[model samples]
Target: MRLAMGFALITLFCSNSYADGYKLHPGTPTFQGKHFDIDIQEHCQEGEVTCPDVSYDSINKKTGARLHLKGRVMFNPNNYNFQGYIFDNGDYSYVLNPNHSKGTESVQIWNLNVFYKDKVIAFDEGIMQ
Candidate 1:
């Protein structure tokens, strides 16, 4: 009985250690698509027209499990402007912008997470749709 109790205690302690070792960073967005995994960090202005910084990481040609890094996105209500950056984890990051600006449209926004097959493929500053 003592041996069994000892084993159980050891197992519980080890499992607890794993849980505490890598707590996912809060505000760390995650996206999972059909062929990619993207993680990003984003910052945005509340109830105002402003651009937030975004950092991204992704894996292409992914068959099973990958990672992506992306940057933040900015939105403008005055001119309906939108722009942002995405980190590809190699070389240069990509930039995105809305085609047109729609002024003072009562915009709503949020950080986004795209998931596919129970895995993260993308992380975006929540949508302002």
Candidate 2:
């Protein structure tokens, strides 16, 4: 019942979201993790027109470091079943991979791996709904 209400609120918040790019106001639907808390909003770009890209604001709980990584809704053939909302910068990356569809949630599971050069420095998984 609670999950359904959450999904309903998610639906209400996400309805008609792409008219001027993805705009998640105030970040109610957030990725809650132990070491990181991430939220997303519409990526504001310079120019006359609005961008359809999305940006993630991630905060490291331990160090209080924040990252404003920008990316878009990527569609990969291999990851067709998942939400390919992915971001990468040099050796650092944030990928929102899928777990399994419990119902109709877009961001149900998260898989993030922070890389330092070639090795992964941190890995965290959490729920987003």
Provide the lDDT at 15 for model 1.
64
Q: lDDT tens digits, residues 1-129, model 2?
A: 999999998876665343224333456547766667788665656541334487888766555566788866555457443354767787776666555643245547666667766587778877776
Distance (Å) between predicted and true CA of 41, model 1? Answer: 3.5
- Give candidate 1's root-mean-square deviation (CA, Å): 10.9
Tell me the tens digit of each residue's lDDT in model 1 across 25-123. Answer: 444325433333345555555644454556565443223224445455555557855554434334443433332343245542333344454455654
Model 1 misplaced regions, further than 4 Å: 1-30, 59-70, 74-78, 83-85, 88-91, 95-129
Model 1 residue 86 lDDT score: 30
